[model samples]
Target: MKEFNNKELEIVKYIKEYLPFREKHIISTRELSIEIAEKYNIDTEKTSIAALCHDLGKRYKDDEMRKIIFDNDNIEYPKHITGALLHARVSSIIAEKEFNITDKEILNAIESHTVGHANMSMLEKIIYAADYLEPTRKLETAERIREKIFIDFDKAFLEVVLESITFVLSKNQYLSDKTIELYNSLVVN
Candidate 1:
């Protein structure tokens, strides 16, 4: 059992009560992110904090997400996104405004963990990878990522992003422009 900061503890309590179904996912992400950060010589505290709160917005309904996104003028909400992806933006807002998170890197990690960006910080990479590789998530792509995670962070991240894109396409689901931008940024030379 990790001792969370006051704010982290609050977020944890909220998650436990609101998203009991995903309690394991949150903890798994936090632990895996901390491990990845330590392995890559990044800050463990920041990684842990970011991972712990990454999915905070998942507790909200679609209507609540719309309000949160509308209120956070700073966040550029996509023209359209599935209710599932909207949680990432809402989580980032709550992480800072409600949880008193002041670290830009940690906030960025939380924001970009879902759809990675052009030039992600090391902490961002760790959080994004850990979110996908968390133990609660049992995808074949996750196993492949685990095999390469300790070996190459960039490669593993790219694989996860590609896998996500492929999954979205296979389902004939709505794809965010950010995902395409991320893919171009990472893969297009």
Candidate 2:
């Protein structure tokens, strides 16, 4: 196993520390992410970093996510998103500026996973799809989506986006305009 940089190493430590059941599984989440990357023939390092850092923005307590979006270069992130929706955008921004994540695929996959984009790259589709269908995820829709992920990634992505929108609507929450637009574009294209 290749050793990680200080920061990457810290990330590994944090995942092991924070995520539940990581130790019980034969493959660490980081290793599983890399394996998923390899299976899809994507860049292993980029996927590894993106997968590890996907939840970085969830560190926020007491509107910290809102504060970062506010402080960023006039990015104008809407305050409507609460709960898990906030992490996707914040992690993308943080990774781009702070963690030196230059791969557009990695950044975009992180940004859009919570509400996927239209016409995503294969790598983006893989990460978004993998995160949703990963064995640990236990949402009501997990089994339904897993088949699409294995049988058809594009269809799986569409289903993921639609499902997210449906879930948000169920909770009476606002769906990001980006999400709506992406959904429409995907349906149209």
Candidate 3:
């Protein structure tokens, strides 16, 4: 378990209340966030908060998460994106409305952790890396990325994005336009 400031503790309490079953995973992300933030000299508090709240929407049933997307007029829930990914958008919303997180970086990190986005900030990249490299993730590639993270953040991030796209293709699932857009922007730019 990682130590949290009083403010971060509030966020943790909120997460625990919403995601009791996912405590182990959530804590793992938080600890990873702290490690990444410290290595990068970024704000660990914000990174931890973003990581803690990243999967809050996963607590909802698939149908419920879809309802959240359906109910939001601003979000265009394409049929291509799965319910598992939809939780990122919903979790960002919950982080703001339910947890009163005003930081856009934290919100964007939470929203973009699943599919990622173009032109990610340092904080966003840290949370994304932490989410992907958390200790519980058994993927051998995760260890590779973890090793490369300190040496070269962007390269590792690009690899993570590519791997996720590959996984989706392997499953014969539709890839979101946002994911494609992110890949193109990163690779071409």
Candidate 4:
């Protein structure tokens, strides 16, 4: 097991408390996130913390998530925000309010992990890719993206966002405008 500082340990403990069943997934995400961060010369500690807390709001009910989203004036709810997408925003809020995570990059990564934004920072891109390509996913597409990450990160990110959009559409879920913006931004640039 990797050693965590006091704050990281506390976040891990909170994750265990709130999302006990997702421990393996969280660990895998943290490890992959750290690897990507190290490769890109980003902050591994921040990546680790964001990955650990990325799903913190998953345990909340849809109504609870809505309440949190509406109550926090700082959160700007997307036009087509649905229950599936609410967790990302709520997780960022929890990370900020409950965990005292004040870093904008970390918070944005957590918020955009599920549905990416128009212009993602390297940190956000890493978390989004790591969350989807974590070892436990067992999807061949994930493996392909994982392989692509080292060779061409932007291409990998574009593929991940495309995959996410396809998945949501296949499920007949409400696709957020932000995701479309992300796709357009990547393809247009």
Give per-residue lDDT, candidate 4, residue 74.
50
- Listed in order, each prediction's TM-score against the native is 0.90, 0.77, 0.90, 0.93
Ranking by lDDT: 4, 1, 3, 2
- Give a tens-digit lDDT track for model 1, residues 1-189: 457887778988888888888899999999888878878899888988899888988888877898788877645555467567888878888888887898999889898887777777889888888888887788776987876888987778888888888988999988777778878877767
Query: What is the lDDT for 32 in model 4?
Result: 89
* Candidate 4 ranges with C-alpha deviation above 4 Å: 74-80
* lDDT pick, better of 2 and 3: 3
Please give the ranking of all candidate structures by TM-score, highest first, separated by commas: 4, 1, 3, 2
TM-score of 1: 0.90
Q: What are the RMSDs of all candidates, in order? A: 2.1, 3.7, 1.9, 2.0
Clashes of 3: 0
lDDT of 3 by residue, 45-116 (tens): 788889888998988887788888778745666665666788898898888887788999899999988877
Q: What would the C-alpha RMSD of candidate 4 be, to one decimal place?
A: 2.0
Lowest summed lDDT window (length 10), candidate 1: 74-83
Question: Largest lDDT belongs to which candidate?
Answer: 4
TM-score, cand. 4? 0.93
lDDT of 2 by residue, 71-178 (tens): 875555555667477777787887777667788878887887777766677766666766665666567686677655656656777887777778789989887777
The per-model lDDT (C-alpha) reads 0.83, 0.68, 0.82, 0.88
